[model samples]
Target: MLVKHFPGETIGIIGSSMASALLAQEAGRLGYRVASLVLQEQNPVRQFCNWQTICPVYDETALRHFAGRVDVVVAETGLLSHQDYKILAAITDLTLSDDLMAITTDRLIEKVFLDSQRCLVTPFSMVTSLKDIKEAVEYIGFPCVLKTTQRHLPQSSDHVILYSEEDYERAERKVEESTCILEAWIPTEKKASLTLVRNERGEMLLYPVFEVIGSGELHLKQVRYPANISSMVEAEMRRVAQVIGQALDLIGSLTLEFFITSAGVVYINEASVGLSSEAIFTLGSMSMSHFEATCRALVGLPLPDLLPRGRAAIALPLVDLNYDEVMTQYMMRTDWHFAFFNPRGHSVEDMQGYVIVIGDSIKHCERQIELSRLTHHPK
Candidate 1:
């Protein structure tokens, strides 16, 4: 069944991707119908108010049903079957590419572009067999890292850092599971990402490059705006992003990750094709949301005119189970939204939970968060 007023006008989301929920929020706010696909395990009845869930057993059938119902169909996380994308093309517009491009998935494609273009990239080689692995190590050097060529699946991101022959052999069992890309591990002096968006008319919007500081565990610790890098490096990052976007013939938001070495060298890290509202939200605060931009783009609308007003914002994820108990006792001073203790409902991975708090000063933000840690209190 379809809504009567906006007959044949609904936005379709293929998975429970973060972008799906965020964009659904915006679309729902604008009185547009949002129909989402829910797997068997998900709660189909309790989707966000702005959206409805449609379940289909087959990929092509699902695509056909959704195409008939929605004006725009967006696949989040690149999780949909390729055949689904082909089917989606028959009925409605399928916009937005998976964000994790160049740096992760499709490394060969990335290499092809890098080879022809002057844009700088991390040195990498693909490993198809055991012999190829040895050759790759010899060519790319030791202490090099092994990752998959296709970044489509979750397991593809699992990697091993080879320090020795034994380490290479130890990693061989796992490396043989997928197509690997071996790259020299550059010691990162800093990490930053640029959120780039382009409309159907090709007007590009570049958000303030945000710095990501972490412990190398792949867990994001912090995000800061107006990236604190040398002007030369900053300019280079933007130039590279612009070049890549043009090369991809990109139409929506693109997220690019980078590494700035201690030697003032910059290396491309990773990229995602669609608008990452979570990352952009951390940098821009409430004034602008990538969710809104994505909704407009999917509907063939222009991007919301937004500018970085120089307001500093920070986002920290709270992964402890006893988050609320700790916050009640110590975090009495600062403002924060405990995602795990949501009044509406609980979300996935509450144990690996998250909370968002904003502060006028970075020092204030850090202090408040540090004081609120679950490990420091009297047990």
Candidate 2:
């Protein structure tokens, strides 16, 4: 049986994003009042979100005030300051803070489960001072990732990889201002994400494993599901994800990133504490919205089994609007579909264009995306 939280209550979200907006819509659809705390009214393209219409929280003062008004607070944007989580945690009624300390401490939220028998973690140490850096290097060796401990950069990627003593020296200087995690970079053959929801009772409902295709784009990359990775690797990824979930005492929805190296080793990367819309999109394209999954999880309702409905689906972010003239090039394609669109004249800050394509095969889908890029992308 699924566990339930407050029914028909309002749920608060921090950050104005397509993910938050879609999540808010889902909550409202599920009979709960939804309010999003955001910084601006204008839609800023959330590098990590799909749908748009996020509520704006313009400033720190606004965020503090917004936190006091909602019953349940969820931070969708990874861009959080310490003040954000502190304010949300202060709201005793009910609150879900994302990987605030996980990112801030540089401890992969997955590391919270290092004690578990299921995990094989790399040698790592916390960097608190300049001296700690030397110990970390001595212990973990070179070619390690130096990252802040907080989830300060939720929507985008941050942190530096040190491959030499000189690189480590520069990264160590920044350590005094933030908690850093020092860990060996695992070179994996493939990468995947496990998005799941844990009921209040601690039972976990694992979503289908989704493959993460690396992109040169900082955070606005494409993710494909119904992965091509080994079923064994997928199973192990799920197993490790569950271990991390239980260890963190994670509530509601979460996402765990992993590296499945050519050697068949699955190294846990990071953990996301709130709803993962990117993974949700993969599921959404397949069948149901992850937004619905979150809503159902929040209310303690049994989740519907998700089956792949579409064979191949792709989402391309409209990053530059100035190239509006080029849109006609993609509009010419017969194989693509506009799953979502921005109202005419309504502009987005981070991304100005949007298109979603679903085809009969991944090859067709990839071809459409490539073709669209060739025609519309600015030279």
What lDDT tens digits, residue by residue, belong to model 2 across residues 1-379? Answer: 2234565576766665566656666677677776655556554323223222334433566666766766666666466655656655665233343443443323545365453445766667777776787787786777888776665644225667888877856786667667776777777777777788765566666766776555665235655655677888888888877876676665678777777778888776766677675653453355556667766666666666666656766555545322453356456755443323343346543234334566666687678666555335455
Which candidate ranks first by lDDT, i.e. highest? 1
Candidate 2 similarity to native, TM-score: 0.77
Runs of candidate 2 exceeding 4 Å displacement: 1-8, 44-64, 77-92, 95-110, 115-117, 153-157, 201-204, 214-219, 246-249, 320-356, 359-361, 367-379
- Candidate 1 residue-wise lDDT, 274-317, digit = tens: 64744634423544566666666556566656664335555554
Alpha-carbon local distance difference test for all models = 0.62, 0.61
Worst 10 residues of 2 by lDDT: 44-53
